[model samples]
Target: MKTLRHITLVVRDYDEALAFYVGKLGFDLVEDSAQPEQDKRWVTIRPPGAGPQATTILLARAATPEQSARVGDQTGGRVAFFLSTDDFDRDHAHFTAAGVTWVRPPVDQPYGRVAVFADLYGNLWDLIGPVPGGACVG
Candidate 1:
């Protein structure tokens, strides 16, 4: 079976994105190596506690005007990502304390508790937590 490996996320600057994702969101920096041929860094990050084969985000610096324009609105003003956490309260508190911008407060859904928040670049994300005795909300 095939598995999705990496999702490229366009950003204005790599370091700034790293600062928000790693410093604030507590994601793990899987790699940061120089790709001299292209004058770019091959940077990858993943959520904490993710498995080795889990999908990782590739922080890609915008190299063109068109790509730059899409830096924040990757999904055209809609939510761009969904982050799943086992502990909703813990992660929600951590994100709030880290100064993450909350778009909507946590609310209980039929499947789980979910909240919307924006990333450093204004990309919307849903922070989801599993319901009791159930998996994460779809």
Candidate 2:
């Protein structure tokens, strides 16, 4: 079966992105290797406890003005990412204490408990988790 791999995320800088994703969000840095020929680095990160085959994020440094302009609004004012968690309260509290900005309070959706938060670059993400008596337990 074919599986998705990495999703490219444009960032102003690699280190800063790592600081936010790894340092704050607690993602695992999968790779960070310099590609001197291209003057770029291959950086990838994934959520904590993700399996080896799970999809990861490729932090690509913005190389042009146009790309930089879209750093945060890749989705045009829409939620750009979904961060699923097994424990909603745990992650919500951890992210809040870690200074993550919440754009929407947690709400019990039909599928799960969800909250909207902005990433370091202002990209919106839905922090979703299974809720008791909800249908998203799987």
Q: What is the C-alpha lDDT of each candidate?
A: 0.94, 0.93
Q: Residue-wise lDDT of candidate 2 within 56-134, one digit each (tens)?
A: 9999999999999999999999999998999898999999999999999999988899999999999999999988766
Pairs in clash, predicted candidate 2: none
Q: What is the lDDT of candidate 2?
A: 0.93
Top TM-score hit: 2
**Candidate 1: tens digits of C-alpha lDDT, residues 27-131:** 999999999999999999999999789899999999999999999999998999999999988999999999999999998888789999999999999999986
RMSD of each: 1.3, 1.2
Q: Please identify model 1 stretches exceeding 4 Å from their true place.
A: 132-134
**Superposition error at 12 for model 1 (Å):** 0.6
List the lowest-lDDT window of 10 residues for candidate 2. Answer: 129-138
Q: Candidates' TM-scores?
A: 0.95, 0.96
* TM-score, model 1 to reference: 0.95
